[model samples]
Target: MLPHYAAPIWLKGGGHLQTIYPKVLALPSVCYRRELLSDSTQETVVAYDFIDAPQTHAPVVVLFHGLEGSSHSHYALTLMHMVKQKQWHGVVVHYRGCGGVVNQSHKAYHSGDSLECEWMLQQLRQRYPEQKLYVMGVSLGGNMLAKYLGEAQNLALADAAAVISAPLDLPMASVALEKGLSKKLYAPYFLRSLLPKATQERHQGKHPHLHWDHLLASNGLKDFDQHYTAPVHGFDNADSYYRLSSAKPVLRHIQIPTLIINAQNDPFLPPEALPTAAEVSACVTLYQPDHGGHVGFVSGPFPGNLQWLPQTVLTFFSEHA
Candidate 1:
């Protein structure tokens, strides 16, 4: 059966409203046990916060947050809350330099960097061999998860996976976020968080060759990626980075049961850029609802309910597990 999502009457049409509502609203607090893992580079360590279930042998779900997002992100906390309610173990992977600590290395996390994701999964599987493992990622994290799933086909990283609001087609999604009202709203917000971090990393001599002035002039994602992301990540340019990193082309190679959910009203991706049936493998299920802006899939009336996304994701994982 196809997944059906009905937006509340008061929150049906506007994408912006759907996207912004949850961020402004507050959910219950969740406590986590922090675990820091040293990276392969040896200089830096990434953090993972574990929310253990009450039962001893509960299923484990690994969560990947979006660009510049951490375990404290609204979606991360809300989903972790749901995982606890289901008596399942949940852990949120904090990309390098994102776990409230500046990474020792110059390289930061990006949408296409799946090596870290693969490493984290392998470590989790080794640590908890008795438990069933599942994975879910949001936005940029979703893209990385999809790429990892497709690339690591035969390896049993997790029992099943889900990707939400991912910008699968990076080039198109970049364009969508760069123009019109989206540029006016989203770009500035992202830059506010990203620029300072980039600057701080650079000041610590992470990228001595790149001109700090040039990178500092970048006012948006595209400019920032062109100047900082591509060069530091070993890409020829931003376009090449997008083409190589995009999850769309690799979707057909995925072997495990996976769910890909996107909202038609997502401000970050154009509807035309979404993949067709031919683009994905038989094991992949695509659920595109008419309304759930970006990472926001708010339902219920008035102030709204925060459980829709977590419920949908958990249901998919449960079915496959």
Candidate 2:
């Protein structure tokens, strides 16, 4: 077994520090080649790639970012840089407007956009037919990809997969985030970006049924999902959306070698909500650390680095491949 992960002593603030460290301090300078790809809905999203010998049959790592996250996210940059160091190709696929491209579709991306996840993987599989393909998803993207794995395991879109800090149980996740620091700090952080685009889309007549006041008045993700996300995505309400979207229900169906790394203390998902070995197929491996909060897995000395998460994920992929 790999060595156990222990948060650096310098990160004394616990989950909060583990969660915010990389996002606030570990951002690095790197270059990427951007490509725009459209889905079945004709909505386009950009993929920022870190490439080395584009035509080589070397392995390819496709990453899916969290809600409102893009290629510029700390996790994306850190992982892609690591991929480059390994001389492997890596690409971060942005979800709709998250890439600053302002998606054309009237509907916004959701927590359970499994179809979109598979569509992107299919495209990547086609582009690199002979190359070994590995997939990694962070937070929201991780949950979506896990759902896709269970629903489309027969397709075998990837040789291996890794999910980081995903909230597999949406209902539980909703309640978790609406309380504590998740509500006070993270909610406003996400709302600043979500409210504006949703507000603009409402003004453009893309969301005619939603109350403008409610969308703008949303204090947390639950309220926003109820007002905008559920209705726009064709779900009856937030409750129904959460019930049908969570990956926990379908984890037993996964057939690919998959690693699910959800910190036991993740603010977004309570310890009780985590799936047990009985809840998953033999192909699924759980790595529930005592720390690492959300997608934050900082390690090293005084000023921690973002290498732990990427190294752990890549090591899993290498083993499976």
Candidate 3:
């Protein structure tokens, strides 16, 4: 059964405030043992292990961070803190070219990059062969996780999975980001990192044939994808990239018990693109709450904390009855 979520009156001001609320709150600072791991392609990716969690026998909770997010992200810290309280192990796997380091490969991580997901989880699975392994992915990472689950079918990289704020339909989510308020708030946030990374890659003589003028002057993600991401990753254009990267089309193929949480109030995704029960397999559960803005689930009195999101995920993971 899905836990009911009610947005506290004080936290209510719609998705924008709820979404932005987590950034201001004083989240727990997890003492993480940073581990640098290499993928099958031999490209370096970072993983942060909760130093305090009992690694000997406890279940390992693996997290994949959102776009441009790292193990130090507010959500990561909060979730890992919760894991520590439960005496479970937690690890946040950073996407390539993320975690404050430019990766070695020419291509940056994308919404459909399931191979990396498989590699990282398998590596961890091998390390903790006797313990239960579970996984969650947030936002862009969530999308990639869903994609991986669908593509891998019953491969069982983890015992179960949860996805938070994943934009399953990449094209539709891109359109939602173009909405007036979303455009103003998020475009700058993403472009800030994306542009600089592309610039650094440019300095390394990558994407020399791309439209340098337009790429440098990119106004939003669409523009950035068109000029840089699409070409660099071998897609024809932004539309093609969006179309192929979406996980929506493959939901029915997933054979594991996967929970997908998409807050209806999230401004980053269009409600129309949300999948219905008929669209997914029996093992996939859709937990579409009416609140919790774009990965933000804040609840409490004066200065709120981000317990709802992590609690929701942990509850779903813990319930065996």
Candidate 4:
């Protein structure tokens, strides 16, 4: 078993954490207030909202999931429970296809898709204009959230935000996933979740252009992105997507107080993928630890609860809020 100090403040992927917390994951969790918002293309976007009991004017904590994840994901549910316990509301933003309900438009979710975050925050501001809004994104979701903050640094949609295990350097992250034993373990898990949804969309005639053979033949996430995500999204190639979509460039532009956690031992992000303390803006805090096994931070002995990240998040938000 990994020691307690080995567990860092952040982890990159939302994949294996579910396997580690299967028992505690079965606990009765609070349900969120779900809604479907429409974009300019008239697509129905799914969002789950969990309002606090007794309605305190606390910050609305938005949780963004990694590839093919929903609010029901163990981490999302666990964080939602934490938010409720702290007297704050929680909202999980489900990317277009991830909500189990297909969106009306063809634009699916991507690592750099920050438009949805912008739109969701706008909607939240309209309803609860007085309440503070913040977001905590995991893995790819973290990349998206960071990009959004950097892109909209001057905007008032969010007061502050936190990104747990974000891959600021996507190219490095891709390389990490491709190395030796890591490839055998990580690639298949992502493909299993990503491919079927594309296949489903193809069957539904929403994305008839997607080719199953091409998708199946693809070896890694970068390969899949090169063939599918880039072409559909108007990028030159996977490299361009990795460069432009990466959050590193925008990290310096973020005006809001943001915390980014990177684990040195994360299977997804290499040690080099971690941002240097100098790279962070005055408002950004980069927390790096010796280990965390890609979001697996088991604390205590009896329950071995995963409370560190959530509690740190609450404390950070409270201090800056």
RMSD of each: 1.2, 1.4, 1.6, 4.0
Compared with the true structure, all predictions reach lDDT values of 0.87, 0.86, 0.85, 0.74
The runs of at least 3 residues in candidate 3 whose Cα sits more than 4 Å from the true structure, single-residue gaps closed, are 48-52
- In candidate 1, what are the lDDT values of residues 80-127, reduced to their tens digit? 999998999999988888869778876778899889788888889987
What is the Å distance of residue 35 in model 2 from its true position?
0.9
Poorest lDDT segment (10 consecutive residues) of candidate 3:
46-55
- Model 4, runs deviating above 4 Å: 1-28, 206-212
Error of 2 at 318 (Å): 0.9
Q: What is the lDDT of candidate 4?
A: 0.74
Q: What's the lDDT for residue 14 in model 3?
A: 88
| C-alpha TM-score for every candidate | 0.97, 0.96, 0.96, 0.89
**Model 3: lDDT of residue 78:** 88
Error of 3 at 226 (Å): 1.1
Preferred candidate (TM-score higher): 2 or 3: 2
Best by TM-score: 1
